[model samples]
Target chain A: MKLALVLPLLVPLLTAVACILAGASRVAQRALSVLGSGALLAAGLWLLRSVDAGGIQVVQLGNWPAPFGITLVADLFSAIMVAITGFVALCVAVFALANIDPARERFGFHPLYQLLLLGVCGAFLTGDLFNLFVWFEVMLMSSFVLLALGGERPQIEAAVKYLTLNFIASGLFLTALGILYGQFGTLNMADLAVKLRDQPSGVTLSSAMLLFVSFGIKAGVFPLFFWLPASYHTPPVAVSAIFAGLLTKVGVYALIRVFTLIFTADPATTHTLIVVVSVLTMITGVLGAAAQYEIRRVLSFHIISQIGYMTLGLGLFTTAAIAASIFYIVHHIVVKTNLFLIGGAIGHVRGTGELKQLGGLYRDYPWIGLLFLIPAMSLGGIPPLSGFFAKFALVKSALEIPSYWPVVAALAVGLLTLFSMTKIWAEAFWKAEPEGATGGTRGPVPLLMLVPIVAMALLTVAIGFFPGTLLDLATRAAGQLMNPNGYIEAVLGRTP
Target chain B: MPLQLAFSIVLLVRGHNEPGGGFIGGLVAACGIALHGIAFGIPAARRLLRVPPPMLIGTGLLIAALSGLPGLFQGQPFLTGLWGGSVPTLLAGQLKFGTPLLFDVGVYLVVAGIAVHLIFTMAEDQ
Candidate 1:
């Protein structure tokens, strides 16, 4: 079991090293990335099965006993996250193979991509708080390069803003960790959870708020999310897809982990703040999405708005609410990445990601348009799709809490989401081709790229129809989180 | 160029135990790289480094992230430092060695890499 946890982290690191040594060899880089990602995907699936048969599994490092050593715990929730990350990474790699310029093969893109995967996997699997921050830095540093890869004016401008914002966030994370260490004298998350349980007074609450603000900035909640939209669309499409799919969600996952396990006692104060901010996040994000005329920019804003839904679930703080949030997160990652990949393909066929310049794509690329529609509708929460089920579950949970404002906000956000989706559809795919369009020739949409998008679309539909499996997985995960004594006990041995 | 080197040295010396560390130090070093570009040429610097600036940034990040792995097994949070004997290797045993040293090294590489890359790219544009 420990092997399962370590394998995902090690494979990427090893493959990255291998890619570097292989140097300028496209075949070597591709083979190494595929094999590495494939093995991780297999390991993630096997871990999922293991969890379904039993319960959460903990992997304590270096034969160290729990509480003192760093631990990797994979419940159903983490397994799902790992699997999703592996799948998305695999697709991004394939897309890069087809789309990345061969001349630029030696530029270290492949190595960084693999390293980024290691960071993402590590973040999902680790059962400690400080380790989580390290992984966040790992992910951020790689993303900084990817963002500035081409170093165009726009990319540079975007990267500077991105770097500055995240630097501040990392600084906040370090300060929070310092406070947590000072208060509890430990940084192992499981141990912190134990120490937090018996803290004399309001220390836990204040520390928890500090942790929340730190993670919230990464998660892109309303106030701190400005960096996301300002920079996300400036990167190349493949880079955008990976960032769109994985980065912010890692923050959200961290929030869910901490709030449920380490800080479950105070809902009225913490959860209400989450709820209020979530509503504002949703409204502002979708409105931002609606206001965008550029295709990628619209998608970027929607990322923030959809994150609001996921946070809403955590804020509602129920078994059902979390399950729905998990479901929505998975659904969003697939749909959002696919939409970006489609946007990439559109950018390839046409010259720009601006919707005004990207008309009549459906006529030239009917298959691409059809593929785009599935994720778009799913994103809009249309029925009989994964998005619908996720939203339905969350909205139902909100109503159950009988929380009128959140329920209304969730419903309204869904409508705005649909409006934004249609806006992209109308301008990019439906509108007439502009006159004097050169209709420049482009290579056919690469199969490697197409396969991942189609696979994701199929998964979206399949999950919607047979949501029972994912739903059960999410429920068990939420359960493990709610009663995280098992997590703490597994990481650190029982007292006395 | 001499002044830039002096700045880099100043940054590296003040980095430890201060707000400035390898990251800031490396950025300062990059300012030196930029000076080299101004004094010489973009192609000359590129030939000297043998990789683009972005790749350097990528490699720096990799090193920095990898620096945290030891903490995972030490029962410390990721990136948490481990220290052993502080006996000096030189200077009459006045100096100490620690994991923070390794972290500083990682920071050094990252800072230097990013600095060089930024200078190279900016020079290319010019």
Candidate 2:
């Protein structure tokens, strides 16, 4: 009933068009970018507050009723996600001012960036399976252009890789949707949830598997995640930061959203499969990180590893477990994006991301080094930081189920994560610079760039300091998740 | 009638419920405009349009977005279809006065703008 549901998508859509309309004036584009993002942040906060207080909100497009019309639904998980999306978009928009080359700007980086946000917000807010597919395409289209925008040889090569794998994933998702629609005659997610309950056909199971593989590829799980590391490190850091922060999580959010709300008929077999995937994803991701010599590449691999923890939260499938996953997602988005931004700053100053060739950063730039250490340690689950609480919540949930294997995998990943962080610390910040090192002589790092890094770092520290509110929110989100009845009631106006 | 203009008019009029819409119709127009650009060159096309492509894109998008606002005023969802009570004019016949039709017009302008801009800019590049 709430009209606020539409704002999340509408605001971003308007912002994107505004950015495009600004055209050729980099200053105007930047101004529009900031203003649009600021508006989006407000919309996101407003959405979260209303959803948190008023409960799940569904906006029927053009006044059509549910199970028929395209709907934008805002549950707690979606609201939190939309809120964080605005924050990341705001930070990255500012950072791009300094980070993206002027050449890219002239090629319409600002508009494309806003379009990307539009697509992302649409994906988060959509309540129809088919609508989700459309949004995914929107996101993928913009991402493809953004990745290849600069036309660098590496950018092109990596863009092809990024584009190919994601296209396949989209095809798989679309195929899954086609089958589900054929069987149920509905694309509305809540309607599907009602119809598919207690009906576990072989066709349904196979379709579920298809969805798993599809979202897994996007989420960057084991064996399906090869494209992520190959391409993520190749983009400009701001682009990579947003990509790292939000893109894969959309896949993860989809996984959690669909499996919990629709595919609950065969949790025994499907959940088991996810658990095994989580273990391998963790082990392989950390191992991959260990082998990487570049800072971005190492961080890229860690993204896979950290994803395993979130999947572990999903695999456990308890209220607390899902809550932990939600918490983990927020913490990772902030910490990981900040890591990439800091990496960008280092590359800016030192002229390279090659770890061995980089050193003595702590000596010359202790402030930057300290900024790096906070997120890095938090990532490794250092005590009194964000990651530790996120890890603790997941492990505690695992123990409640007495599921030892995922707990073991989660613990080992934490240790290896620490090892990888220490490696980056030793090579990039602690050890002395290799003789005759040179970096970009763009003078000192500009305030525009530093501001985002510091803001994100402070946010991470604040999350560490005040875990109670977020934990409560995650708990409430998970509660609504475990029982989809409220969501169904909200959308359908009665129990199915 | 010119082949380009005839084809574009057909495509634009037949778009909404048919297979073709703003995208294809605009592409149709773009083909005609592109031929014009190639034949007469970029300067001639700019002179003919009387405005730049970027401006076209902006105005088109503004129209598209503004077309949705009235729905919000009526307490309905944004961009919901809204038809008019007015009798149709000769030109506006078959095309209802509604947000949906306006949206399509907006899309047509946008598609036309983007296609022409890319084509012209690339032409200038060479």
Candidate 3:
């Protein structure tokens, strides 16, 4: 059990080292990358199974006791997250075999990629707030290099914006950490939950707001999400897919963790604020997507809109709502990642992602078109697909609370989301090739790129077909979030 | 230059019980290397460090990560320190060895390599 908890962090660190040592041989590094991701997935699944069967798993590092030593805990929510991260990392690693150019590969892409996974797994598994900050920095450093690896003009421009904004977000997070430590004298999340409940609401609210904004920026929420769309499309498609699938979701996970576990004191105020931000986030994100002509830019905007849906469950602050949020997160991660990979496939085939420049995908490569349609329709919340269930659960929970405005906004945003999806389908797939266009293949589409896209699309279909098992797991995770005593107990070991 | 390097090693070793640690010690060593470069030339400094900066960084990270495996083997959590009996040294009294010390040594190499790499890059650009 203890070994399982550390595997997610240790495996990636070791893989990165091996990649670095074998840096001269591109083939060796590539093999090691795939092997590492495979190990990560196995470890994640093992940890998830253990946590599911035996309850929350905790390991205190270096023999230090709780609240002092670095604590690594895997609740069902975190285990699911870590497992999904491993899954996505594997897919992206495979896709990069074709998507990344030789020059970038030689620029240490494999080692940096492994480091990024290490940081992400560390973020998900860590139990301390300050430790979370450290992991965030690790993730930030690797991703910054990944974004700028090619050093193209557009990439450099996007990297600057990304770097500046994320640093500010980190600054806000650090300030919040300082305030919390001053107030409670502890940075262990479980310890804070116990100490915070007795404190005056006013003091906690300030730190909560700071943390919300910090995580809010990372999650791409309203009034602070400008960085996402401006920069996401500039990187290589494989990088974009992993970033889309995992990066923002970590912020959402932190929001869910802190809001549920640590800041349950004044939900009436904090959650209400979240509801307002969520609705605004949804409306604005969908509107932005509707206006975009580029495939990736459209998908990036949708990331923000979908984040609103995930946080809405938190704002609703009910057991069912949180479960729906978890369900939504799982479904969105798979669907959105598939969409980006399909976009990459489209780019590979057509030599461009501009909808106007793209055409005849449905006519020439119907297999690719079919792959694209699954995730596209799923993202639009078409019935019987994964999105439908996720949206249905969230809407049901919201209406149960009788929160009518958010419901009205949510349904409207759903329609807008469909409009954008159809727009991409029509412009990129259904239309004929424009005059003076090459009208045929850019080059042979690499099977490596197509494999992960198909796999993720199949995952979308599977989740849509078998929502019951995942929903049950999500409900159990929500139960843990609603009552964090189990988490607190596991970390602090039966605190009086 | 040799005295400076020796002093930095002292800082790194005593860091477990004193104010000095890997980061400061590495910075001090990097400074010594920089001073030598300023006086004796960049090639001389580079020759003084036998390996490339990146190799140092990678090796340091490898050592740090491997240092944790002993505890895993001992059925403790990852990074749990396992101390060995003290070994008598000629200069210092009995010096104890443990995973923490190994971890610090790894950090020292990494920090020093990074500092030197930055300095070399900046100086070479001129």
Candidate 4:
């Protein structure tokens, strides 16, 4: 059972090595990447079931036991995140197969892709704070290469800004880790939670704030999110899809883990900070999304806005709120990734992602049109879809907090989200196709790419219909997080 | 030219536990590559390296990220290190083996790869 936690991280690392040794053999690299991701997907699902049937499971590595060595933990939250990451990664891999040119595959795409997954899986499962930082670096490094993979003018420019800003963020992260370690003398998250229990309020508040700010940059929270829109659209579609689906959510996941477990005592400062940021993030992100004329750029900006929804749940700081946030994260990842892939397919067919150049795609590519519509509507929080359920749960939780402003802000964001989705639909799919367009004659997206999109879309709808299962898992996960004692006891023997 | 020398200094400073490590090392190495491209020509370097810079960067990141896994399940943080067993081996007498060493190797590869890539790109422009 513990091996389940270890395998997801191990499979990708081994596969990456194999790919490297294979020396750019396209077939071998692709096979290894796909096989590795498939294995991870299987492992993720198994872990998800185990968590659901049982509860949080902890694996201590190298026989070192907890608090002294490294620990991999899979609660409902981490398990669900791992599952979503695997599903999206598998999709991205298939999409890359179609998207990456044969010549480039030999370079480093397959191996890097596997390594990126390893980082993400590690981030999701690790029970320690410093380990999270390492995972972030791992993810960031791969992302830099992927961003610059094509090495076009825009890519280089974008990569420079992206790399520079994230470098600073990474530095800040390290500093924060040093501070946390200095303050508590421990980097293990579970142990820190226990040790921090009796700490001075000032120290606790400051440390929490420092950690929040660092993660906010990565999560693209308001004021720190300028880099996201500037760089996200520069990448190839597959890279953007994976980044959109997984990276920011890791930050959000970390925020939820820390705030709920470690810093639960001070709701006034932390929760208020979260609430303020949530509103601003929503408003600014929607405004950015609304202003964009490019498909991918709009989607990228929306990533910021949608993150507001998750933060809203965190701010509310209740079981339902956190569960809804988890649910929202799951829905958003799938829908957002699908939307980006659809944009990619549109670009592949239209020769550009620009709205002005793209038109009447719905008629030319009916399958893609359907695929895009599902996620689009889902993202808009239309009823009878996963997005609606996520929003509903969040809204209900917000209202329960009796916070009128947050409820109003969430409702408004939903409307704006719909508006942005419609804007894309209007310009890219509904408008008249330009005459003599280069991609007008291009065929429909290949089955491999479309299958994953459709599968995600189906999952979105299915979860919407039956929210009980996921809601249960998320609530259980939230409960575990809220009661840090269980986690502390699991990681450190009996709280002291 | 002076920038490369400065970068080397910074990398040295970063070696202990600060920010400088492999990533900075790679960037510095790239500066050196760029200098070579300026001195020589783009195609000449490409032929010499036999691969692109982005690939190198990718490979480096992969190696670096993989080095952290041993700690992840060991109940430590992802990149946490553990050292054990002084080797009583014939040649070396005693040696330390741990995750951080693996991470350092990852840093080395990533630095080398990115350095090569920066050089390649600069050379291409020249």
Candidate 5:
């Protein structure tokens, strides 16, 4: 169990090192990259099983006890998260084999990719507040490099905006950490959960707001999502797919984890704030998506809108709501990533992502259209697909809370989401090629890229068809999240 | 530059107990190497190191990650510091050999490699 706790982190760190050392041959680096992510996936699965069999697993670094030494904990939520990350990383790594330009690959893409994975897994596994910050920086640094890897004019421009906003967020996060430590004198999350309960509400609310704003920026919630759409489309498709799939979700995860564990003192205030932000986030994201003409930009806006649904679950603060949020997250990660990959494939064949420049994919490559349809419909909440169940649960939870506005906004956003998905379908797939457009003589989408897209699409169908298993797992994770005693007990060895 | 390198080694050895640690030691050593490169040019400094910066970084990371495995093998938590008998050193009094020192050495190499790499890139770009 102890070993399992660290495996997710260790595997990636070692893989990244190996990738760096394998610099002499691009083929070797690619093979190592695939093997490493596969190993991370295996380790993630092992950790999930152990955490499932024997509840939350905790490990103390350097043999120091809890609240003093760094801690790594794997609950069902974190385990599932790590497992899904490995799944996505493996998929993207494979896709990059064919999709990434040789110039980019030669310039250290594999090692940076592994380093990004290392940072992500670290963020999900670390139990210390300050440790989480360090992991976020690691994740950010690699992602920033990945974004600006080729240093094109547009990429450099986007990266600058990304860096400036993220640095501000990081500053706020550090300030919150300083304030929390000043009040509670502990950087351990479990310890803070215990200590924060007795302190006056002033520091608690202030730090909570600070954390919300900081994580909100990361999650791309309302009024702070400008950077996402501006930057996500500038990078290579593989980079965009991973970013769309993982980066903002980490922000949502942090919001859920911190709010559920550390700031339950005044949910009436904090959660209410979350509720407001989520509703606005939903409305704005859908509106933003509706206005986009580019396939990736449209998808990027939807990421923000969907973030609203997950945070809504957090704001409702119920087992059912949180479970729905978890289900939504799991479903969204796969479906969204698959959509991005499909978008990349579309761009690959057509040579442009602009909807006006694209058309008749359904005629030329019927399979690509079929591939795009599954995830696109899934994103739009079409029935029997994963999105429908996820949205249904979230909406049901909201109705039960008797919060009518978020439900109204979610349903309305659902409609808008469907509209934009169809817009892409209509403009990019249904319409005949524009006059004088050079649509001829391009090769079929590479099998390497098609393989991951198909795999993720099938996974989406599987989840849609068999919601019970994932929903049950999500319920258990939510139960663990709602009751902090288990986490506190596991980490501190005493129930708070 | 050679004296500075020796001083960096001293700092690294004394770091486990005192204020001087791998990070500071690495910076000092990198500064010395940067000075050499600045004065004598890139080729001479490359000869002086005898290995590329990226390789140094990879080696350092591998060493650091490997250092943590002993604890896991021993049935303790990962990264648990396990110590061996003290080593009698000339400059620093009896230095205890442990995974921490090995980990520090790894950090030292990585930090130094990164600093020198950045300096080299900046110099080359001009």
Candidate 6:
């Protein structure tokens, strides 16, 4: 059972080592990387099923008990997130085989990719705050190298900005951790939850604010998200796709976890700040997307807006709202990743991502057009898609809670989200290929590349169609979150 | 260079309970390699390493990961300390050699691999 508990994280880490061991054999590395991701997927699904069936699962590394040694605890939310992380890893590995160039592959892309997944799984599973910070550092360092892997001028430039901003966030995060640890004498989240509720302090609020700034930058929230749009467009499609799908969400996860678990002392203050920031984030993100001309840039801005939706539920802080948020995140991850892959596929065929330079994709490649439409319409919250239910659940919860301002922002952002998706649809797919442009069919997009996009798109459609079970899962996850007694008991035992 | 290599080896061995551990010892070892690369030139140093520096990373990682597996076999959690029954040591007093020490050795190799590879790449670039 403990072996099953750690497999989701252990598998990726071992795969990272295996990838490095393959050493200069790109073919060997590719095969190993794919196998690793497939293993990760199987482990993830197994953990999800087991956790879903059996409540929270806890395993202490090196056999040290909680609050003293690091614990890996997977509750409903964590198991779900890990399962999705593995799914994305599998899809991206397949895509990278076709999407990444040989030069990049030889530069140890496979190892770095596996390492990134390892860091992500580690972050999701670890129950210690300090361990979470360590995982953040692991993920950040690998991403920095991956971003600058090819050493291209633009990538190098973006890497500098990305690293610099994230370093500031990291520094702030570390400072907050130091402060919390100094005051509370514990870093185990459950222990902190038990401790902080009994002794509230001014330092806790300040420390929480510091944490917000750190996670805010990483989450790409308004006023701290400039680095996202600036650098996200500069990476390779595979890099951008994963970064778009997973990285910012880690910050959001941290925010949701800490707020729900430890910072309940003054939800009145922290939750209000969250609600205000979320509204601002929604407005600015959609507006930002509306302004971008490049396909990836538009998608990048929408990621910010989508993040706002996820956080809004946190701000609302109701069980239904949080469940809606969880559902929204699940829907958004698949949709956003598929959309980025679509952008990549178009770039594959047209040699550019500029909307002006791209056109008649619908005319030339109907498959790409259809693929784009599913996620695009889903993103816009069209009926009978995952995004619609996600948005509907959130809207209903917000209206019920009467968090009126965020509710308006959510609906307006949905409209603007649709506007930008159509902007992409009309410019990239609908309009005739401008004469003497990059739109002439270079060739069919590689089968390996197209397969992942289709898989994710079909996943979106499947979730939309059969959301009863998944939504029920989300509701249970939200229940576990709103009442974190199960999480606490799992970590600290019943009496403690 | 030989003295530095010997000193680093001592540090690596002495690292389990003492101040010097895998990271610092690895850096010390890399310093020795850097000195040799400077004196004898890089190509000769590269020839001496035999295996490429990057490959050392894989080897070191596998070693470190493998060190953690014995615990699982013994029905403990991953990475539990499984010390071999007490062994007496000169100067260091009682040194218990086991998986923890093996883990440190793995870390030593990994750090040395990374540091040397970085230095060599920069040196060769010039």
Ranking by DockQ: 5, 6, 3, 2, 4, 1
Error of 5 at A450 (Å): 0.4
| Candidate 4 chain B minimal-lDDT segment of 10 residues | B87-96
Fnat measured on candidate 4: 0.00
Question: What is the C-alpha lDDT profile of model 2 across A322-438, one tens digit per residue?
Answer: 999999999999999999999999999888999999998888888998999999999999978899999999999999998888888888889999999999999989999989887
DockQ of candidate 2 is 0.62
Stretches of candidate 4 off by over 4 Å are A198-200, B1-91, B94-126
Cα error, residue A35 of model 5, in Å, equals: 0.9
The candidate maximizing DockQ is 5
- Interface DockQ of each model: 0.08, 0.62, 0.75, 0.09, 0.91, 0.80
Which portions of model 1 show Cα errors greater than 4 Å? Answer: A198-200, A439-443, B1-126
| Candidate 5 C-alpha lDDT tens digits along B1-126 | 999999998889888888787888989999999989989998889889898899889998998888999988999888889999998889877788899898989989999999998888889888
Q: Tell me what TM-score chain A of model 2 achieves.
A: 0.99
TM-score of every candidate: 0.82, 0.96, 0.97, 0.84, 0.98, 0.98
Per-residue accuracy of model 3 over A23-115 as CA lDDT, tens digit each: 678999899999999999999999999999999999999989989999999999999999999899999999999889899989899999999
User: Could you give the CAPRI-style class of model 2?
Assistant: medium
Best by TM-score: 5
**Residue A283 local lDDT, model 2:** 93
In model 1 chain B, the worst 10-residue window by lDDT is B88-97
Per-residue lDDT over A89-145 for candidate 4, one digit per residue giving the tens place of the 0 to 100 score: 888888888878775686688888888998999999999888888998898898888
Which residue ranges in model 2 land beyond 4 Å of their true spot? A1-3, B1-21, B89-95, B121-126
Cα deviation of A247, candidate 4, in Å: 0.6
Ranked by DockQ, the better of candidates 1 and 4 is 4
Give the runs in model 3 whose Cα sits over 4 Å from its true position: A198-200, A439-441, B39-44, B90-93
lDDT per residue (tens digit) for residues A273-342 in model 1: 9988888999999999988998888998999999999999999999899989998899999899989988
Better of 2 and 5 by DockQ: 5
Tell how far residue A236 is off in model 1, in angstroms.
Answer: 1.2
Error of 2 at A95 (Å): 1.1
lDDT against the true structure, per candidate, is 0.80, 0.88, 0.91, 0.81, 0.92, 0.90
Better of 2 and 5 by lDDT: 5
